[model samples]
Target: MASDHSLLAHLVPKLTRGVEDAVTDALAFILNESKPCRDALVDMVSVGDRRLASVANARTQVVASEGERLDLVAYDTAGSNRLIIESKFWAPLQDGQARRYVGHLADDGLAVLLFVAPEVRHETLWVKIARQFEHPSELKLGSTRQVGNMIVADVVNGDKRIALMGWDTLLAGLTNADSSMDANLQQLHCLALAQDEAAFAPLHAEDLNATVPRRLMAFNRLVDGVASRGAGEGWMTNKGLRAVPGRDGYLRFIGFCDTDGERLIELALYVSLKRWADLGTTPLWLRIWHKQAIDLVDLKHRLAEPGWLPAWSEPNWLWVPIELPLGVEYEDTLDSATAQVKRVRDIVVEMA
Candidate 1:
């Protein structure tokens, strides 16, 4: 027969204290590195602002309602432009107390909230926080977990909560970054060389194959030579590309490219760690220049219909035109899938 003593015995006060002490140690380690934590907070704000620029008071904390109290708030004071911050460090409290803090934050309309507990690692706290948000009638806590001991979160109503971690696949991405960069430029140069009548001639197959695996591998070597470094997430621009580490081994890249001859390109690449294992097709997304001039809906149907290898069958060759940045407007014209197809169509359209 089961005994009540068995369960109650394990819940001794001494054991509970020991666990509390351990969590305290973890929290202390995280908070001790002031610079990293601050940098992480800045990154979190930048991400939120970029994603949710429509909201008013973008980076400031609101006044708490009658029975609430908050820890930190990041918001914009005037229409999402200038940023404001508010933070508080409180001693570890009971579950009810934590819930109260979160509730206070919700009432105050804080765009971002940070709760720094010196007794528990932020990751452990986040799981509890996520559940809180699920029930708005109750309370929702927000935070993040990143490589090393960084934590941040989005508390704003419409803000995108980004989960950041150390992704090994990002290193794999480096393996081909530089080579792809150079080849893209070279292909742009080659196409320019083909002026007027030459442009009317068949596009070079070699130019189309420019940013293949070999070039990507060479680029990784170049990144390796420089040693891995982070420029912080806040550096992201509507035009520049940024690579961010993600949970497990996934890496997310964001940026735009514009080549000569007035063609604009914007691309987002998601490189999975698993891609390196078999070297299979790495998931990719591209936004290219002058997209509206093409027939995307027709192309999508043809692609799904199968046995439709009209021209460039090699996935590698399809990368050139889509990847290389040209100097023109291209967003409304094409999507990622259509851009890749256009790279091949550009050749066939000319050949025909």
Candidate 2:
């Protein structure tokens, strides 16, 4: 899967989700449904030194013994709460969140209060949470080391400890442990993949480059090419900041015909990922006005042919979405886009 693209994430994008809460819910679902998944998770934590029975259960939005609302809680076979988990994304820890969980540990229960966060936050989160076990608390920061690929921080109170792990590391371990995972695990993995891809990292010196703007300018040139082609085909072209709240800027084409006793119609091709027009399930498509003189039924069927993909909605206006080919070179892709746009326009002219 590409960055920011996941099966579950495609339906619910990362920007709209309460990332911390969503992670907690998805993981809890997988662990509760699959006992092997729970064992896999514990295997990563204990590094094969310990094992979690298949009967263990996982719950989310759990109220800890210390009255703190934890993101996840894992219960052993005997129904004892042995694993207290806190899921973090960008949100800071609540007031004394780590300290209270450490204080809640009895040191005799063999329980672990674990915090899972992004890899970028691994070192800093470990240090920040380790500070909570200082002075009066029975727990002490024992050691920080690499357990396989995970950067694990151990906060020791005799045998029991609080561990910090990265979400990426945890997901990787689980995947390696079980390759034939079910749909829940697969969906959870997709969500994690999207989160990892979307999470912005700390800025580096090499990021200050001109490549980003140069590519944006290339896209502008591509649109200009399409507009030029449309104007040459006897269609009026207009360029403007044509974007709705959820849509991107678009290039438009206007045509005048005597089909409906001399009328003018407009069509626009949006360059955004957002769904400004209803084109079935696809996020990629162009929008066209429904005020046309052509037969609606014939138009719908023809639009469903090889090149065009069209969908009907409750609205009075309909969009003609054309799928374009992505080429390596800028001019190649522009030519492909221009050809597709021309095909759609010609179809309309013939039908009208």
Candidate 3:
């Protein structure tokens, strides 16, 4: 558990008060200096208000506010258009912050509220945060409503219309801008790619084959057989074979097997960390057997055997050991593996 905290801490930087201010400064500079970038932004958020493009090149005033200050406030002098941008790099909106920010723009004529973040970095976490301030009807992504002649891409807090723009979208717009401005935007784009790459590095077959041990490889093949059987029986999705390498440099699997025949069962299914998080506080046992009405006493006793272990309570990972008969040819083990998986499945059905 402590390792998990350390891993997260190492991967994600501690967001300070000034981080948003720095982002605001960079974004404001690009919007004011680059006409193409500004026009793209206006086109994305102001769907019906095409006239906003006229002010894309207008002399703009950009201000960064702290505390009561809305992240970035840009005013176009020529068109008298105001863009109130709330930029969140890592942090979620504080309590009532969204409402207060929208309220600030309520009386400001010809103004739009834009919420910008790197959605890819945080997965759907930022999307869920944005939904909290949104009306139930505006829950879908890219949802829009017309406020008079102005178009609001994401409406929140009753009539407050806001646009949620991802960093990737902003980068695409910046890419089409004049090449002369590459020096300024290149650093930002590189940083964004680095963040994305760190999150999702591709796993190669050769890399796994070379690093993984033979025992683990055998265990993975057995689990793959179990998954295949489950999918064939219409109990699981046929996602094909997946060898998820954990942060600990070990291949994480759903089924476990012991090399010796000391244990009664040859193989049993387990749960992964990602699966645990997806299931929230629900126990893996409950999630797997919830539809069945199994006796708790029998279920507990069977799971308490040397070969069967319940999921961990703290980290919530399921790791049940299964015995594989020793001194058998590696090729001959498949029949046993298949039989074990069927036995586990049968136990579920019988206990139900």
**Top-lDDT candidate index:** 2
Against the reference, the lDDT scores of all candidates come to 0.33, 0.62, 0.49
- TM-score of each model, paired residue for residue: 0.24, 0.63, 0.43
Candidate 1 lDDT tens digits, 156-211: 45343323221122112222333433332233222222111111223457757957
Better of 1 and 2 by lDDT: 2
What digit string (tens of lDDT, one per residue) describes model 2 on residues 1-352? 3333356766656356576678788888777766666788777666435443333887888776657677887877777667778887657767568878765544444566778877777776777787777787675777777776565555653545567777767766666666666555567766765666555655656666788556645655666677666665555345432423332544444443333423345655555343432222433345656666666556666778764555443246455554555546766776777777666655667786
Listed per candidate, the RMSD to the true structure in angstroms reads: 25.5, 6.6, 17.7
Error of 1 at 60 (Å): 11
Instruction: Please provide, for model 3 over 242-333, each residue's C-alpha lDDT reduced to its tens digit, 9 standing for 90 to 100.
Output: 44545422232232212221122222243233434433331122123222244434644466655543433223223333345668975556
- Which residue runs of candidate 1 sit more than 4 Å off their true CA positions? 1-41, 47-63, 71-75, 79-90, 93-110, 134-148, 152-157, 160-352
Candidate 2 global TM-score: 0.63
Which pairs of residues clash in candidate 3, taking residues 3 or more apart in a chain or in different chains? none
lDDT for residue 275 in candidate 1, whole number 0-100? 31
Report how far residue 324 has shifted in candidate 3, in Å: 27
TM-score of 1: 0.24
